[model samples]
Target: MKGIRFWAFWPVAYQPSSLQASQPPSLFGLIGRRMTKGQRRKLNRIYFMKYCSNCGQPVIHRTPPGDDRPRFCCESCGMVHYLNPKLVVGCIPEMEDRILLCRRAIEPGYGKWTLPAGYLENGESVAAGAKRETLEEARAKVEILTPYALYNICHVNQIYLMFRARLKDKRFGAGAESLEVKLFGENDIPWEEIAFRVIHATLLKYYDDRRLGRFSFHMENISPPNPNPPKTDN
Candidate 1:
């Protein structure tokens, strides 16, 4: 919050108040109402840009000449910065009747069971990233079989790509990012302790495919539940 500043233009009716100085200005009020806290937070993360990366000058949020949506633009350098979703790659390491899982040692969903997956690095292919993450987290070697499931998590701005993979051997151990690594059968999966919703969805689909004796590609959109729903006048 220290580095974040509110520099967006506001309507003449509103004045910058000292009480709300730490928070970003509300844009929804310009159209007549205030947005929910969750909505504003999501919007702020996506659009907030204090300084332009090109010229090290302050940026303004506005639509470019040809673009429909507003972006952080630099007046000094004439640069428009676009924010995009990140790709997360991972694979389910299968060894006949069992698959591998790791207990995370990190903050988000710590101590919970999850597949060997992480953010895809630059200059890395999707399949290669999946294998690298698998080896890094679970210390396991896997051969990617096929692309299994894709999840579009709009709320968090992430695209998860899960792959079906076969374990090269029984040799695997916990890596630095994992508290422990182990294999679990379909029935032995800890349903309640799964890390993220996308991972949970991938596992559910994977087991379903296994039961049918066939594997197929899957795609889904995942979002958080809305706390406030607009009401219509009767």
Candidate 2:
């Protein structure tokens, strides 16, 4: 389990980039240009399987007979494991002049403000997942309008899908994963204390679009902080 009830609802396999193979940590490293040893270790523990799902045999990390890349393989049962990126779904829930937000009661940014969002469930639609996260974290009901932002955070092997929505009503409270639930006007937002870069980026765009009187889809690759980068998706 991706504990703490934060954004990381599920564990994902971490694959080191071949391009980042042996370079020293540099400015580009902050942007996922390279995978550090710590990064490799963090992912391996969560994603590397020890036992074959097909059988009760221990698995080995190796390339298959004809495969070029390394994989988790079971010699006894001939099972192979492949990993992929994860999808994080959430929404920007808005009322008349404010946006609904949750102060996380979980780690990976405990007690900080954030949009209502979480991991996309295996079978849930993207918009449905966003709505679910909104209701789950803020106890706010919302009707999703349109996708507002998409972030390709390659550094973390995760993608973010954020939607713009209209809050059903003003009635809301903190859910299990939040310390407090509140509505924030753009000027009142906790810019310095916001949880993640992607959240900050999304909010910035939302406010900008509002001023422009036109909302358009936004896509960007987020870069990690150069120093003391905060944990993102657990």
Number of colliding residue pairs in each model: 0, 0
Cα lDDT tens digits, model 2, 1-234, are: 423222211222223332223333442233333445555444444445767788978766556767676677677878887767889999998899899889999999998999999999988999999999998998989999998899998767899999999999988999999999999999999999899989999999999999999999999999755756577895
Worst 10 residues of 1 by lDDT: 12-21
User: In model 1, where do residues sit more than 4 Å from their true spots?
Assistant: 1-26, 30-40, 226-234
Whole-model Cα lDDT per candidate? Answer: 0.83, 0.80
Best by TM-score: 1
Question: After best superposition, candidate 1 residue 213: deviation in angstroms?
Answer: 0.4
Cα lDDT tens digits for candidate 1, 1-234:
434433344333222331122334554342234445555575556545678899988776666777776666788899889988999999999998999999999979999999999999999999999999999999999999999999898877899999999999999999999999999999899999999888899999999998999999999999885668788899
Residue 91: error of model 1 in Å? Answer: 0.5
